[model samples]
Target: MNIYRHEMRMSLRSMLYWTTGMLVGLLFFMMMFAAVSEEASVINLIVSQFPSEVVRALGLSTLDLSTVLGYYGYVFMFILLVASVYALKIGISALSEEIRAKTADFLLSKPVSRNVIVTAKALSVITLLALQSAIYSLGAFIIVDIITGQPYDKTVFLLINLSIFLVGLFFAGLGLLLSVSIKKIKSVLPVALGIVFGFAILQMLNQSLADPVLAYLTPFAYFDIARIINARAYESAYVISDAVLIVSFTLLTYIIYRRKDIPSV
Candidate 1:
């Protein structure tokens, strides 16, 4: 409990920064929706001129930019990217920071077991992410209501927003696994950004190539916004994949962390 509290306190500023950035970005996108709604057809025409592959890669091929939900879907790509980065950073740095700062010796010297320490840090990251997702959802609802002045499908809206959280979880687990698996990490940001963008680029390839196999390579491809909006639910296969990924990586992280050697300070 003490470790959890300390981790949360250390992470509070970062949590606020990410939440504020997401909220501000969502508000800015929603504000633009009004103008875009008016000129949707014109914008669509302009978009149509772009290559079909490019349109699909950008997640604009099948979506209608005229509607609030459609605009939200497009803006969601950016939101997901940012959210994934946050999750990955949290996961990568959760334990690595102790080692990087040469505080692992101090932390391990305590009476608590390493398992407890890892659990507490992991919980702190998950709690912070859940809070951010909840706040972002509320802000999205309020912004959409104000901008569109029409009630969107609540079910679809929730599912769409929920994907952000789920993707964050998957990446968080992956990040944790990597943090423990690696021998030494001098800097986490570069590695985290590389992994996040690498997966993102894979997703773009999946979109452009329309390959089923590539979808399995990236968590971002798991939740298709178009399918969610149309079917009003997430695809079962991807949901199961997400569950498996999170569980597998989390277990692996615990296993490795429990036995892994910590360098003497």
Candidate 2:
């Protein structure tokens, strides 16, 4: 419990800042929805002139910019990207912070077991993730309502925003595993940024190639924003894949962290 409390306290400010930035950015983008929607046909036509693969890669093909949800879903991809980076940064930083700061020895001096410590760290990250998702989603819905003054499917809007939570979990899990697996992490932001963008690049390939195999490589591809708009629900296979990968990463983190030697300052 002490460990959990400590982790949460350490993470709270960073989480709030990131969530606020994302919300503000989303608001800025959604504010343009009215103007964009009015010119949707011309924009869509210009988008169509590009190669089909390029169009699909940009997600300009399926998502119509004419509707409220369509525009939200389209621009929301940037939100997801930022959210993923934030999640990964915290995940990598959470466990690694103690070590990087040369405080692991002091932490291990406590009576609590390593397993308990790992559980606390992981749960703290998860809790912050849930709060971040909730805060931003609520703000998002309210913003859209106020700006558009137009009715959109609440359920689908939610499903679209829910991608942030899912992607956060996946990256958090990966961060924990990497924290335990790597011998040294000089800086987490660069590592997190690189990895997230690498996967995002893979998502571009997945979109362009339309490959199921490539899609599995990137969590960004898991929740198809456009598909969520159309289907009004998440895709089962990708959801399952996300669950499996998160669980696997978490389990591997536990196992590796348990027996690993802790270097003292």
Candidate 3:
């Protein structure tokens, strides 16, 4: 409990600015939804003018755009991108900064165990992501509900939130692994960002190549937003793959971190 509080305090202090910025950015996108929902002609014009590929890429689809959920989902595609980036950023410093700042030595000098430290940090990251996601979803829901006056699928909405949350956990584990393996914290953020963007590009390429087999190689391909909308259920393969990645990375990171020579603070 003490470790959790300590780690949560550290994470919140570091990430509060980014979380606030994400919420503000999400608000702007929600406002755009409000504007577009005011006119049926505008929605028709958009659907007519936009290419099907473009619409799918942007997470806009053959759904009724005037409805609050559809509009919120449309705008949320971009917000998701930002939120994912923020997740990577949070993870970059999760363990890497402790090593780089030479604080790991001081912390370890205490009675805290390595697993406790790792678990506490993991909890902190998950807690931060949940808080940010909840705030963003709540704010958008209120804005959209007021504009459309209709209740949508709360189950599906929560599913979307959970999917993103799981993805964040995957990235956090990846970041922790990198932090343990690499000697420098400065390299953590760029490497994490590169890996994420690289996965996205692979998903795009797999689509271009027209290969279903390739979809298994990347998370983005399996976790398609359009499919998510149509099915209203996250792909089980992705949920399983993410679970594997999280577990694999967590174990690997713990092993490496335990062996690391901690420098003085």
Best prediction by TM-score:
2
TM-score of each: 0.96, 0.98, 0.82
The whole-model lDDT of each prediction reads: 0.89, 0.92, 0.70
Residue by residue across 43-153, what tens digits does model 1's lDDT show? 989989999999888888878888777888989888988999999999999988999999899889899997898899989989988988898899888888887897678
lDDT of 1 at 189: 78
For model 1, what is the alpha-carbon lDDT of residue 264?
A: 71
List ranges where model 1 is wrong by over 4 Å: none
Candidate 1 worst ten-residue window by lDDT: 62-71
Most lDDT-accurate candidate: 2
RMSD of each: 1.2, 0.8, 3.1
Model 3: ten consecutive residues of lowest lDDT: 55-64
lDDT of 3: 0.70
Candidate 2, residue 79: the lDDT equals 91
Estimate the TM-score for candidate 1.
Answer: 0.96
For 1-265, candidate 2 gives per-residue lDDT tens digits of: 9999998888899899999999999889988998999999889888879999999888888888999988998889889999999999988988899999999989998898889999999999999999999999999989999999999999999888888999999999999999999998999999999999999889888899999898999999999988887788899999999999999999999999999888766
In model 2, the worst 10-residue window by lDDT is 256-265
Residue 192, candidate 1: C-alpha displacement in angstroms: 1.8
